[model samples]
Each structure stands twice: as structure tokens, then as C-alpha cells.
Target: MDGTSQSQPQPPEQTPTSLSPSAQLDLAITLALHNWPVLSLAVQSSWGGPTSADKRDWLCAAIAELFTDRPDTDAGDLEEVLLQVMNDEFDVVVDDESAGDVADRIIDLKGKIDKGDLEMVNKLWEDWKQREGKASSVGLFKRVETNDEDQETDEDEEEDGEDEDVEMEDAPATRPPREVIEPEVDEDGFTKVVGRRKR
Candidate 1:
């Protein structure tokens, strides 16, 4: 009880700045958007980051703040770029993170989502889908199935490939001259190394 500050509430548990490296990049990139100057001022002025963990949470909160203010203009590219950067840097050799923890966190974001306060995070999801291709897309804590539209598109591609194969088989053979009468070996003991070169 003595450790507790009487006037101030205890801060949340210290998570990594941005929770993960990718999240860090996403937050920074998202802040650079148009409303960034205004948003940055707000975050810097209000958010007290005595610890590194607090700094990240603050950054994310700032971006969410901007998104809330300017939803239409927010394309979510910042999140995608950061995620791409993260993937290139880190290998996904393990999937050992806890699902329950993930779900809990996603639930926590729901209130923000309701407030139109989740932009880059949502954009990150779209980018994830496009990058994963046939495997489909996923959200933060959300596992999305890559829809049948892509599958149907793939099937169309296979059909086109089949048509191409048929066209190739049906086309007449333009190649000719499998054999030729060597022009008397150019009067030497060795065959001529030049002249058309058996092309």
C-alpha cells in the first residue's frame, strides 16, 4: 500500500513500445500523415511518457486520435508500410503468442473502433490480406479468410493457361531443317566452325 501513490492511479502494465516492432513503425508512419502536426502537438502536450512503454502507447493513441479527426483522408498506408518493413526484418519462425491475450486486446480496441478511432490498425489489416494473397487477410487479433473472389480469379487464370497450352499445341510447327547435307565439310578434315553455325 505504501508503494501506491494516493493521488494518481497506477499505470497499465509495461508493454513493449508499440507492443511489437511492426507496431512501432506503423505508429510513426501514421503520424506523418496530413493532420500529423496537429495530432503530434496534442500527443506531445498531453501524453506523459516517463517510460519507453508509455511513449509507444502514446504514439498509437495519437494516430488513433488523428484518424478520429480525419477518417476519410486516412488511407492506412502507413500501417501497411510498417508491417511490410517488419516482415522483411523479422522471420515468423514462431507463432507462440497467446490467443486469449490477443482476443482481450482486440476487445479493448472495440471501444475505440466504435469511436472511429482505429484507422492505421484497420488499414494494416487490408495490407495484410493483399500481401498474404490466396491465404486471405487478417486483422490485428482477427484471422480473416482470403475470400473466394481470389480463388475464382485463380481458377480463371488456370483456364487461361489451359487455353494457351491448346493454342501452342494447335499452332503449326514453324521450325524446320532437323537435318542438312553438310556442304562437303568445306574441303577440310575438320568441319567449318563458321557460316550459319548450325543455328
Candidate 2:
């Protein structure tokens, strides 16, 4: 018997051209979220419970829904959504203001998608793939050990210590419940309501 190698059929690669506008927006949102250090830290640390990964996916859907409901959705609205979700779902208060940047990137990508420009989406997808490949090869979320002396600074030690010592505590037993605002569609068929939770 002659030894001959046969190549196996490969699965179809998902390119930017293959995705619909909605799917492109969803992928853009996911890439933006993953690139955010705060959200990445939260997921890596399991801040949103054991299903933190699922929560991130849910966030992508929620953000996509906002765009579907209102094409004119801006960064301010998206920032509020990011902040609210971080506070409620992950019990994390993102005071660093990085959420605004993430929101802006998402909105920009959305606008590009609306205009049928998928270049940025394709770039982000490539970046994500490269990052994921590296993360898989070498553990991306490995915890680092630092000595107490190394943490000490010349500035206000107390303030620095306080900030660094902050840990993720369990959510309050009696916290205000989130109120879901119903969408109010106008004559133009655009939703006047932005999904926001009352603090």
C-alpha cells in the first residue's frame, strides 16, 4: 500500500465581509469590551460570579440592542450603560473613567458600520485574534506576586495603600433593585427610551 497524505477540509473563516451589519456591531462591541482593562480584570478575577464570561457576552447583546433600538445612540448613553452594568452585575464601581473610552470606541465602530465601512472592525478582529492566540499560548491571566516593600511609595502611603487594598466585596444584602424602563417608540420608529437602571 502506498502512503499518501490527504488534507482535511477546513471550516469556513469568518471574515468582515461575511458578517451582517448587526453582527459586525456585535463583534466590534465584544472586541471593545475585551480590550477594556477594567472589564478584563473583572472577568479574570471573577468579579461577576463564576459566570463572569457569560455576563460579558450578555453585555455585548445588551449594548447591541441599544443600537438597534436607537441609531442615534451616543457615547454618553453607552458610557452610562457600561458604568451601570459594571456596578450592578460585577458589583464594581469603575471610577477610573475608562468606560467612557470604551463607549466612544463602540459608538465610532457603530457609525462606521452604518456607513458600510468595516475596516476598523476587521482590524479589531485581527487584534483580538492575535491577543487570544498569545493568551492561550502563555497564560494571560496569571496573578503576580509583589512584596510589601515594593508597593511602598514616596507619596501619601495611606492613600496609596487604601486604593491598592480595595478588594471585591459581596454585594449588599439590601441594594436598590434595578428598574427596567420600557422603550417608547416615536412616529419615526426610533425608541425614545434608553435602557438605564435607577440607582
Candidate 3:
């Protein structure tokens, strides 16, 4: 053997379980780097992160927390999807037959709008709009009409104000001359508290 060449040192072995939380997170992000903006950070200005995985994990959790039906939404599901995307080399892969399955889960109205036959494409403005009605926010924050109790309370407060406005502006003064109750006496000669009275 010639023994002319020297070998270079290699990166330390990185088994999946041996990965720290941060390293696992790094692997997750590296896996998804080519896709759309990591939405977790852009979703809210208040969001900041130690790594991409935190944002990704939070993003999936937030989506599930906000809208549970879209995907299974468990972190494990997100992990599986993300890793699947990575294994597929970041090509867009839609598990459901159509985009509507995804739209239905996350965008409540969009799912409702999807065609039943799967052959028909839905029109965004015509069919979907009438179904949504006057709900500008599309049921995210519904405009609930005042309930009976709230209506009654509001009416009482308004009437109370109107009555006060029509009557004497100042409340009548009362005498503050009343005395409190006498203290209790004990056999040991120490005064004990019986009860309190208002002056």
C-alpha cells in the first residue's frame, strides 16, 4: 500500500434520539427551508423564537388550537407532515384529493364552498358569498345579538340614568349620629368581640 493520502475528520454521529430539542428543531427547519415563509413568526408581531422549529411547532399548534378540524393538528401530525415533506424533497404534496379538504379544515367557509362531486370547481364570489350572508368576518367573530339578560341590564341602566337626570341632582344628606353596639364582657375580665354594628 502506498499510504500517500491522509483522511479528514468527519462530523460526529447524530442519531435521532441523541438529538437535543434544539438540534431536532434545527433538523425540522432545515427540512422545510425551501417552502413558504415560516408562518409562525409572521403570524403575530409578538412572536419571537430561539429556532425555526419553535416557530414551526407553534404554528401547527396555533392552527390546531384556533381551528381543530382542518388537519389532525397534533404536533405528531405536524411532525409527520413536515418530515414527509422533507423526505419528498420539499415538493408540494396534497394528501387529500383536492385543495378543498385543506381549505375546509382551516378556512371554514372555504371548505363549505368546495364542490360535492370533486369535478366541479367552485366560484369564489358567487356561490360562497351568498352562503356567508352579511357576516363580513365570515363567522370568525360572529355578531351575536344581545341576549335577554344583557338587554334587560342595559335597559335598566339607561332607565336608571334617565330617572336620575329627571330627579333632584344631589342626593339628600342624612344625619351621621348613630353609635355602634357595646363591647362584650368576659369572665376573665378581658373584653371580647361579640359582633360589629354600623355607625
Candidate 4:
């Protein structure tokens, strides 16, 4: 056998978690720049063209995770860089979906960051993260609108009850046990039916 030195396979790269925050950001941005162009391609082995959802999801997840380390880093500016890379380099227009929303927020954040108004950004991030955390804890598909609508309806009922109480003072307190009276507002901005009883 001839003694020929074989080339050794390179080791896998280190993850950003092992690096400093700034370095982590730099690494993420570098990787994003490199990988973004292929983001739309190979989603489903498109003989026609790359899919938008795959690319959008990839970029959004990358940017979101990239900024997870928030201290002493201009996350907004970094996000702006991501947007610029996608738009300027990739020439992709992202106007709708979570990625677009994230991009819009990043644009807003860039302005605040430039003005040194970090408190607003932090507050917004906190609120957004809180909502995202709660959404994650529950099944994301679960409808939270039910709870919100119920709460709003409860408030409306309470307000209506107050008005009813004022009107009921002159009337008898006891009514038919199965019958209920309520106010119904019409499209004309008027309560057309007041104290209408169910048959």
C-alpha cells in the first residue's frame, strides 16, 4: 500500500449558543446571507419555481431565532439587515404573513434604535413575546377569539344591565321566571327594543 495522506473531513461548525451575543449575531447574519437565496428553492423540488411559503417561513424562523439574544445588541438593526438582504440581494418582496409583520416591526425598531429609544422596543418585544409564549403553550390552532368575544360580550351585558337597572327602578322587580327582558340596539344607533320579554 502506498503511504498517501488522505484529506480529513472538516468538523461540524460550532453553534451560536456557544458564542458571545455579538458573535452569535454576526454568525447568524452571515449564515442568513449565504442560505437565503436557496430558501425558496428545493422546498418541493419545484420543476416550475420555488415556493414562497417555504422561503418566507425559513427567513422568519431564522431572523426570530437570530435575535433571541437581546441584551446589548441592536436586534432591530440586525433584522433590518435581514430584510435588506432578502430584498436587495434576493429581490423577494415579502408583504404579507408573519415574515412581513416581523419585517415591519423591525423597520419600526430600526427607527427607535437609531433614536436610542430602546424602552419602546423592549416593551413591544415583551408584549409580543408574552403573546407568542402563551400561544405556544396552548395549541396555536385553538381559537382565543372565543374568550375575547365572551369577555367583550360580558362587558356589554354589564353596561346594558346598568342602563336596565336605571329603567327598572320604576317597575316591578319580579317578572315571569322563564321570561327575560333585554335591550336590543339597532343599526340606527338606537335601542329599538327595551325590556322585551321572551315568549
Best by lDDT: 2
Tell me which of candidates 2 and 4 scores higher on lDDT.
2
State the lDDT of candidate 2 residue by residue for 44-160, as single tens digits. 988877778777867776687677668788999999999998998888999988999999899899889989999998898777667687444122111001111222331255565
TM-score of 4: 0.24
Model 3 spans > 4 angstroms off: 1-3, 22-199
Please give the lDDT score at residue 137 for candidate 1: 23
| Cα RMSD for candidates in order | 23.9, 20.8, 29.3, 25.8
CA deviation > 4 Å runs, candidate 1 = 1-97, 134-199
TM-score of 2: 0.64
lDDT at residue 96 of model 1 (Cα atoms): 33
Q: How many clashing pairs does model 4 include? A: 0
TM-score of each: 0.19, 0.64, 0.19, 0.24
Q: Which candidate, 1 or 3, has the higher lDDT?
A: 1
Candidate with more favorable, higher TM-score: 2 or 3: 2
Compared with the true structure, all predictions reach lDDT values of 0.35, 0.71, 0.34, 0.41
**Lowest lDDT 10-mer window, candidate 3?**
139-148
